[model samples]
Target: MAQNQFSLFKQKFFSSFFITQALGALNDNIFKSALLIFIAFRAGDELGLNSDLLNNIAAGLFIIPFFLFSATAGQIAEKYEKSALIRKIKVLEIVIMALAVLGFFLNNIWFLLGILFLMGFQSSLFGPIKYSILPQHLSDKELLGGNGLVEMGTFLSIIIGTVIGGVLIGFDELGVRILSVLLLVVSACGYLASRRIPETPSAQPYLKINWNPITETWRTFQYARANRVVFLSILGISWFWFYGAVFLTQIPNFTKVSLNGNENVATMILATFSVGIGVGSALCEFLSGRKVELGLVPFGAIGMTWFALDIYFANPTSSYIGELGPSAFLSQDGAVRTLLNCAFVGIFGGFYIVPLYALVQERCDKSHLSRVIAGNNILNAFFMVIAAALAAVCLGNGMTIPQFFMLTAILNAVVAIYIFSLIPEFLMRFLIWILINTIYRVKKTGLENVPEEGACVVVCNHVSYVDALIIGGTVRRPIRFVMYHKIFKVPVLSFIFRTAKAIPIAGHKEDPELLNEAMYSIAEALDQGEVVCIFPEGKLTSDGDMNEFKSGIERIIEKTPVPVVPMALQGLWHSLFSRKKVNKFIDRLKRLRTKVTLVVAEPISPDEANREHLYTVVKELRDDKP
Candidate 1:
């Protein structure tokens, strides 16, 4: 698996993708950091402007574009092939880099500031395409791995960019020119990489275009609104950015005043955090079993909150300003602990975010993927602005750094509770998962008979609504169910199913496109080593017996040469939600009190998996109640 990850990076297309993304991130941070630093020092009388006002203006310049341009960018992505669009965006980056160079050389703070805003604009346009394209070029299973690599590349690039920007500005004569040239080169390289990207056609090729920023932005929100789970995940994602931006903006001051460290020491602390995010991002692939597993999102958030609070408690009370060298940092126990705390937050941040991002990618409508991403970016920018405003108010009102940290930590709990309440699936999945983990001792036999990893078509009888949940709860790996469209839309169940990336399938007469998409998605999932579950009976048995199997499973097997896992749910069909008659009012009487059993038989090979043969095998297993 590790070798596969490394090999992915070595692939020409993936390598190009990595370089373009990483360098774009690097350039963004380099100029933004340098411009911010320069303005902080010279915004006042040195440039005949109010220092604080100019600094605030600079912040707005960068963020405002996300609100203004992301929608249009998303439209362009959906209207055109992504590879070609990316190539054009890279060219735009090169222009922006040149303007950045010009701004720096002239020491025209106003012009340089304009360039920063343009960089933000450029990034806004790129944001939608960035996420939407992953579902296109990569196989379904590679989504997590692909997302991890992109995130790692992005953050590592950011660390290097900021550090390089900070260091380069210290030079007397040629620093600005050198930085500009470097950014231009990087942008050009990104263009080269983008050119290598394969073609990805638009999902909404004939959809009417909307170019007005504000109107389109509102429309994007509406599009997101139509997909409730996607919308909430967007909010969750936005909230995460808010949380991160606040901490990031404080690093310089936190390092100096709180940690009593020099700039270099502060940089190292920042590096630790960046490296942690990269490590955590990579870890998501393995933890999620290469599927877009949202179970890990809550897991990640828990770590982020815990570690962030620990950092506040971990702060040293006394100053160590004079003792600011690398050697001093290494020697000081407090500094070591502080650095570790910073790294912990970053690592957990990776855990918290990567899955959410992958979930958004895998579950969103392919055509509207970019638009949804744009809405997400807009909300992200809005939340970040709020975070900045809140931080400013808190700091201005005489809150100490540690106190602010503590408050943010506490607020995280409140925010989490609110979001989880609004969408209970996170909590619900965790509950059932915990129940399975605690109440039942699950054992897998012939696990090796099932392909260890890669996409497989899991054929089973539709025993109950909780069949998917039960399989998800007990399977050692994540599974994507190709379920009847309406069942997937059930109120509470819909949220959980979407979060789990279950593909909603309709019959030919109902929604042919969706049906085709589901079929293709199955192949895509298997191609990615994802576990795709499909009930051969298509729906729950109306009678208390399994129906004849459908041919869809057979077709899927023929298309994808991967193994097929034949399984049975022994006792769950007897539960209330199944075909068995129940006193509806009384059923609620014993909801949690009832116990259920789920059993998995060994996987059968594609050649051995004919409908009659596998149907008999599963029927025999289902009949064996124990």
Candidate 2:
């Protein structure tokens, strides 16, 4: 990015925060990796510890503080300026790393373990700040891009940190001192970067810190659940961690045992996995059109499962005689397939996670965001711990690494289905939005005419029954559509309508109460500064012809009196869902992809937002042509 780039997200928010967080993540992985390598390669019977047990202990200790102190962490963030808090955390990291120097000098595993606990505590404090402060720094449109960069940076740092630790610990005589010095330098650098971050005032400065972890932890989860989608998103994110942790934990053993490879092969495996994540995380912005699209979450989940199954099947069927290096491993038939699987799993993980994090930031109440993210961190730690335990149990019972991959794949599917069913919006949006975006070369114009904030009435031509779907899917804001009750009850889409909070109406003569309720719902939604959409022509065009505009729009504006944005959907009347019947449904399917234009016009003031006026503006924007 150019230094003169005007975008805050590109120039200031992302670059500074990305460096700060990535360094923090890198330092974390450096310490953790050094400890693990020591336990695995150096500390064994001579230290009176089983290598495997020590590895498990180190991992457990690192994650335990997240579970223990996340609530307190959340509260602290909410009670102070985030930039100041981060600087303090980074300073503490420096102190911890200084002590780590002593531990290294003394060659004490127990002392390093204590420092590891403190590092975890520092990270726990950083978690809530990491996610919650995003909304403060970036606009909604920028959130996806910012998150992608952050995730990409973090994963890349993980790879770097992992590689550095393994290599440095191999240095003779000077290895311990060298590693200790590196930690202190990284920590100090992180603190310096923290000093450059823009100050983020606390969202809840008046919030009192709760001292009790037990009750406060429970309270944080309650706050997370207050927004159903936010809570579900957190669960979904944690599940990704659990799923990711399982595969990552098994990579080394899988390479050595399953593939009969050397340390080079294990390193190759981890590199492929981490690089895939970086690629995937960065791709979220392009694929999502810079919006918090939940559709990608399911897409990511499905891909994760599919590739995992492929990885399981791609595992070598026959054991080799001796350990193979990276060069030798590549000579095997399944190696390419295995690496591709790892990369795609990480890519899909990027798609899955970026959106969920953006959603949490976009949806969660600002005042409680820190606590909500804290809850998510707690759950993430819990899920990861459980995942580790489950893998141990499975492997202890003679389950092969490939079998564990299959198990995780199956579990992923089950969890995705359960969560999607509980909140059908995820699945529903995935289907509708993905399908429309795929089948239509959708061109949108005058999108800026839609108000950035506050309530508005969206009036569009009712050329097809799917008009609302197309418009709702295209518009970035959450919309409440006023639709005919019968159309609102359409199979598959009815669930979408209900989930999207589409207001269903009937003819006043047919059912006056429903119409009144629908109108009131429209007013209520507008009063809450929400977008409400309605097809002013009242019904889908019967023969590519317009219906006389109804007075319902007049009644809506009279009640809520919001700005009404006039829009036109061209080339949809000939669509399969349009009222124009095709000679054959299969033939209609032949138009699998169509060119559609959604042109929005300037917002008409409330007094002028009549049905006739809107119909005229929409028809003019449609530019009537075959």
Candidate 3:
């Protein structure tokens, strides 16, 4: 399915793993909801515990293992084959579920709580395996689609599990028996499916198991932060979990006390949120054109804050003793709009999470991938705990849910802007992506001519200031541009160039040291197996005619004997960045949505990549459509 992202789900490994993980998620939600509902509604007063408070306690117990055992789990995943470990975890799940059967039979709250802790432990172990295994089985392009499917499966399973568990626990003593039997069967099914997952070799098979969670946790955290982007992405992902936990937890009481709805109405609201998540996950791959697009992250953050604000304003002040059925709720002013807003929040959340997870998988060091993921899980658990506490603190201080929603929405905007400011690359790429896609209808020919791997010198006709932007955006491979020093410093475009690491060159007559440094940077980039791009024409065309090619290409190829691919840009001079009409910025803005075409020619061997030879090739290609 490397050729087709959606077909990835039809493959054997992805399908089996999808089912196995989905079942695990389903079993978790089913057991958790059933137990929580049982405690809230049916647990006898003999225990002498507050139902609502115990509910929160149960939630905390389930996440505590993540904080304590994630390091050990990471080591285990690193030290052993993932599929075998998954099978063993599943078998443990069966045993735990069997124990849960007896605990439910006796209606023993302590025993059930213990089972909940074990379930959390099981999930903690599974978390590292869940993400790290994707890079091994799927291609980079397939990572986004695979993650989308996994997210869809998880949320769809949550909806089913929540509904089924709610209904089953609604029964009398017979419900306990039925719930126990059902959990046992689901655990067994998960084990069976785990058996079918293809073997993925351990990333660190020779690693020693570190049993000390505290010390090992510190080491894992260090490795995770070693990469700046990965660490920042972890923070963004954690914030999403924090946002989600607070929003979802308030739904039940908000539905009952605020919307005046019973359990049925609450279920409908949850189902709507889940449906929206599933839709967003399913559509992400197509929307991204099967790439791990970072642009969607900001797009998602924008929608999330907006929808959250809408939810607050939708029903700013409303409370009732009785209930509004689904029909009556829809009849109320802004009721459907509120539900839709909540649903869209989940939808954008899918966009926010899928790419970040895929980016980590694609970018993180393979040896420490599991540990990084474990650290991420730990941090996510920590942030979620903080979110719960924050919500409690606010409500305890007399903050209404509507007011809290407004506050959280405002906070979300602040957090997003701060994070984006720290890593302007996300915002820069987003702007370039939006500019290219919206301002120009870009067409490409012979994209296959560009090498898919290894270092190559991409020599292209530089007709406009945004040439690198267009080429980099459309090319499958990441390229480092060798660009003009002045253009590379054009305020907003400077951030774009610097973030892309575009080498800034000048003639020796102007700045000899800067030119020399740029040459070395180009060689270093090539040596590191990156595509190094140069505008051999040296400057943007003055009359839509090719200039004499520079010796810069020949000089660089002499130091790094790599393949040279020649490309041409046509239909660009009339736009804003060109000299067609004095190259005014406002002029380009006026011509937004103009058409441009990029053409790539076959690569030339290093020995044949002379200034004259390359110049002829580029000249011929540029003159093709002019």
Candidate 4:
């Protein structure tokens, strides 16, 4: 496995695909930005039209294609090879740019706006294939990193392309000529890059095409909703886009009216926000240990809310005679704080989005992934439209941009709490993430031994009260642990345990009914192809020593008849949650940041998973470490 996301750049396949997609994003933004800028500045005089009305029309035109053609695009992507499809899309971009050159030369706003609609049409077609192809080429471990790089490249391209477009359009006829040439060249380069993407076979080649947008769109949504987690993840991703659109659309005006800043200051703030998103997106691979870590989603949400609120509070009162330039803006009181707020909000937005994208890819059925992504695109566009309307309503009603920012932040908090409440897994993973990251540096080995799918009973030597948590956090898959009822009821930890759906048990003499129910639950979980981990010792070790494995493991394996994997937890005995005696305050200090290791051994066949054999295997794996 590649140790870091950067290593992926060294591979030709990933690099080619990344560049192709990034350039595509760049070209789309460049064209759209140039047209928007022209509409804002020169179009009203040249075309004798209302600029605001024209701007809204342009925005509406661009978004309409996503709604009209996304379902058809999804079906087409599923039925054909992705690489060829990408090259064709790039060719279409070249044709669109050629027409755009004519539109610019003639100074015809209607013609250019028509070209803008075509750009959106092209993008809607490419959307499904863009994400679906990643899974075809990348491994499960590379998925998160690949997504992070793509997101970083995309946002950076948006910033760079938008800036370049604005700057190029500012010059006279010469600027129009230069912009036209740049558009064609970028489109050609994107085509060249697409040529190098390794061929990916169709996912559902035999499927019939659905041409009707209305019915097909409904079917696409049903595909997305087929998996409950994936559906919610789509909603989460769309919500982020909604949140992001609101912030991005208001930045220029906010800088002008609220910050008393010139165009240069606005550009500077926009660059900071985009760069923050890039940095945060790149950091996801590192923070997640190259897996799709859902914990980062909640973490990202909290940061977005906090920083957005700060932006509201960071609004400065100092009045300038004229709009300040970039340097002057920076010198103004509360400027840096506002910039920091923008950057952190962007960073958390990255964290909020990347994992959800990965999860959608990882969980959605391969055959329907393209369609599901198409469904996501439709929702994303819809949400962005709503965002625009909301922003207009709020700003039109005399709400200060800062107050609007505050309102957005508060809405974000409410939405996040509601989503996490609906899917407690995100919150549960967050708590587990906090515990392991803060108090322990976990080193996991032989995790590949755990089966990627299907039922398996994992038996670990229980050392401390937090062994299950450590194991739960480290493993890539969700696990239902059979734990002691007493430990399950621990004050702070109880919430996490119950949310995790941990099975609680007691001895026959202690509580026979509860023990039988626990056993039945474990068996049923395995029957449903879930992973169930149990401490075969039946409880935490009291003296930092291995206890004899109980016959419960045998009984469960006999009932389920599944593979049994033995695991060991080492170096957690002295941790704060352990039963180890701490005689002094200094001893407590030593427990912080303890180095912990979780070792997973190969699965033992059902026939060989007896009490004695499994105990010896777990002991050997622990290497006598407490």
Best by lDDT: 4
The all-Cα superposition gives candidate 1 an RMSD in Å to the true structure of: 9.6
lDDT tens digits, residue span 1-626, model 3:
55566687678898889999999999999998889888887664657778987888799899999999999998888889999999999999999889888888888888999999999999999999999998999987688989998988999999899888888988978887788889999999999999889988999889988899999999987887888899999999999889988877888777887788787888899888887887888778876767787878888888889998988887676466538888888888888888999899989989888888998998899888988899999999999999999999998998878888889889989998998998887887687778787878888788889886899999988788899999988787888999989999988889888988889999999999999999999989999999999999889888878889988899999999999999888788767677777457776577778788888999999999999999889887876443
Please write out the lDDT profile of model 1 over residues 1-626, one tens digit for every residue.
22345568766667787888888999898888787777776556467787778878988999999888888888888888777878888999999888888778788999988888888888998899888887777766677888888998999998999999877776635877677778888888888878887777887888777879899989889988887778888888888888888778877678777777788877887899899999999888766545666666777777778878887888834344534756776786666777787888888889778878887887788878988898899999999999998999998998877778778778877887787787776776665555444443334333344565667777777867767876786565668989999999988778778878999998888899998999898888888889988899877987668899988788888888777777777655446567666667766455443465454577777888888887998787676442
TM agreement with the true structure for every prediction:
0.75, 0.94, 0.93, 0.96
Q: Which stretches of candidate 1 lie over 4 Å from their true place?
A: 1-4, 42-50, 316-323, 431-470, 473-565, 568-626
- Top candidate by TM-score: 4
The candidate with the higher TM-score, 1 or 2, is: 2
Using TM-score as the yardstick, the better of models 1 and 4 is: 4
Error in Å for residue 69 of model 4: 0.7
Q: For candidate 4, lDDT tens digit of each residue in 367-464?
A: 99999999999999999999999988987887877888889899999999999998888998898888999999999999999998999999998888
Could you give the candidate ranking by TM-score, starting with the highest?
A: 4, 2, 3, 1
Weakest ten-residue segment in model 4 by summed lDDT: 314-323
For candidate 2, what is the lDDT?
A: 0.85
lDDT of 4 at 82: 91
Instruction: After the best TM-score superposition of candidate 1, give how far the Cα of residue 492 lies from its true spot, in angstroms.
Output: 17
Could you tell me which 10 consecutive residues in candidate 2 have the lowest summed lDDT? Answer: 1-10
Model 1 accuracy (lDDT, Cα): 0.79
Give Cα distance to truth, residue 140, candidate 4, Å: 1.6
Off by over 4 Å in 2: 1-9, 45-48, 174-178, 316-322, 508-514, 543-545, 579-590
